[model samples]
Target: MAAQPGGRRGPARGPSKGAAGGQARGQVRRSWLGGVRDAIDGLVRSSPARFAILVFATLVLITTALLSLPLARAGAGTGGTPLYDAFFTAVSTICVTGLTTVDMATHWSPFGNTIIFIGMNVGGMGVLTLASILGLVISRRLGLRAKLMAASDTNPSRVHAGPVSERQAVRLGEVGGLLVTVAVSTLSIEAVIMLGMVPSVMAKGHDFGLSLWYSAYYAVSAFTNTGFNPNPLGPAEFFDDYWFQSLMMLAVFLGSLGFPVIFALLRTWRSPRRWSVHVKLTLTTTIVLWIAGAMTFLVLEYNNPKTYGSFGFVKTFYEAFFMSTMTRSGGFSTIDMADLYGSSLLVTDMLMFVGGGSASTAGGIKVTTLAVLFLAAYAEARGAPAMEAFGRRIPRDILRLAVSVVLWGATIVAVSTVIIAQITKSALDFVLFDVISAFATCGLSTGLTESLPPEGKYVMAATMFMGRVGTVTLAAALAAAQKRQLFRRPEERPIVG
Candidate 1:
């Protein structure tokens, strides 16, 4: 234990040149890593929208890899899931689209199912929502741009709601509270629903483990409005249980309302007057659509024996309501979708087209977009220059955005239908329904999903990704690097009806 270096006993050298050189190289390596990390962080901050899309894409790729693992599957016909099937399922689950090429319970091992569960949770909760939450947990701090990115990505209606999450993130306002509220509110709602669901699931399964798993799975799925039926029998098995159906209905309804509404309601339960106009419009419109869609289904499918002829009036009513509830991005079906009267399919298709609210796990052009467009039309008909809603004047930019989203959505649905129509040669009605479902991120199907060719599956998979990230967001990510125009051409109006 002699002293080192310049100590009298050893008179050791300060350092060897080789050791010094190695230390210098290690420092250089560390510096290089730090530079790479900083560059990535800078890129993400500058283009938060693109970064968010990239993050979701990366997550989808990870999910695809995990699901394709041989260990992730049960010993079925093949040792592992096929590449196409795995890719399709990964996109579906991570997008919370719920479209499945294979049966969930029968085809997937426990590990595979868990992977799906985790992916749905991550996807169902906005990707940026999870990212910001993780950042908060790890560093106890987050950037303004990061919060603004989450706000825009989740709530398209708030795309121009500048610095809402940012300012709030600094002062522990709604956006700041959102980081915790997202996780708490989600689990809280799911837990209550799960608890209520257990006895019913248990009665049906007669095994505690089976019931618990089903309860937890359904709680997560329903609250996310993903409508995944892990039940081997499919969701139809619970059709007779009034209590189970009621709980599910509530979960799907609330989940589709989106986090902003949920948080507002939770924060100011008694102050309905203080609720944001977004929440007010969303609730009113949702209730109206639900009732309207339910009545249409009840009238058209009431006597269709395959769908609801045997059910009593009350049961039929439940099924009708459930059907309508599901079409708003919840994919569960109490009866076969194909057996529904053609008129009912049309109704469901329209409902899917006008999906749930912005910032919700639900997808489509979004309820707000439709409401804005219709409101603008009404105002224009009356000769009012501007659209008004809930005593707030709608901005012109928002109108432009709404129009863009609707047109973009319509174009996608039309193109997708044409492509799949040729590939499957399925009936136009069925093809249109499935195409809209894929684009809306609504997992409803016409029994044609499994039969689609590889080409068609890939088409649907890409559509699902676009729907989840938003067509506009995808377009933005790709075009964001372009320089903004500093001048504009003279305006001109084209003739219209």
Candidate 2:
């Protein structure tokens, strides 16, 4: 009608503000997405180390949010978890570190526990390795770059600027197999362990349904080296359950061996000579530490009535061995850590500091680092030009990397320990023990973690984050912050003690 009135001309129209606004919004959205895609590509291509740290940090944030929900607290829908407790628990869970600022068994609802269970499993899988596996699942094939990124998890040098040597624990060609191995081994090991613990859990007066749940939880916790106890009595309920204890110890040993070592062992079980240097060193060093730690604990705690004094010879040996396994980042503890002799605590600190194998679920500087340092010392004692192990020579770069990891880990622990001690004014023994436990991702505590002030808890959470992300990975990320230099500086030897 209006058009007809205007003689075939429409009435004057308004500016197409809605259309223009929509178009502008679309452009902005596209630009933001494009920027994100480009950044992700750069991250995946140039530095998987950075990508890994980013992933863990993201998971921490997400888990924190989930744990902070009102439903996450036990017996309460109205009262939400404290941000401090939620954040600390989130860090500990995602890091697969067992240190907690709250009561794990009684404090959280089933929803919170489920979140923790999922977080530990995801965190236990190496970050870069998980990315590669996801890539494979999505595309049905892993690209060369993806393989390189996955390899970097097993061997940090893959992310550094240099030609990758053929003498690797996992060759580039075998990366696809390694990915399969990681997924399969994690599932199979946890499943088998879960089934084995069902009987023991049932013996504890839990119904079949409850037993299954507890069994599965313990299996995951043990395999992930996360010592979170779902039972109200803690490990004390299962203290005398030999079958459960043995299975837990076995699971922890296997977990601490690292996925690369596990893969290698699976392939070369029948031929030890064919095992990679990494596998050999990890196994040998792990065995040595296990035995030595047990003996040290047995000797130191045998007379302490507060600890092993009440136990007979066999029980004392068993508990000592169990604690030794836990110190290798297993985190499970049946006795009061405060009752341990100071000397025993120092030994635990050392073992925890050494932690587990490279790329393992356990934390600390890693068993491989300890192995490498020892190998280097032995070589130096013999005046060899390079560190040698299992008939293979380790590169100087690896040795330097080991030193860097140790230094980085020690610095983190030292700084956190000082800050926490200052905050709580606690005894150095207890402070140092919990700090190392946090740094090693070992859950053993002198009851110090829960008593710490909020500031101290925050410090411990940061320590757990750094520990689980790994000192080696952190060093690699920091190294990647600067481009590789084309020029070299003159070398000078400095005298040292």
The per-model lDDT (C-alpha) reads 0.81, 0.86
lDDT (tens digit, per residue) of candidate 1 on 111-193: 99999998888988875575555444434566765566556645653433333331121122457766667788888999999
Cα lDDT of model 2 overall?
Answer: 0.86
For 343-462, candidate 2 gives per-residue lDDT tens digits of 998999999999998888998888888888988899989999988876777889888878888899899989998898889888999999999999989888999999877777888999
Enumerate residue pairs that collide in model 2: none
Model 1: residues >4 Å from true position, as ranges? 1-33, 76-78, 131-140, 157-173, 481-488
Runs in model 2 deviating more than 4 A are 1-37, 134-141, 161-163, 480-491
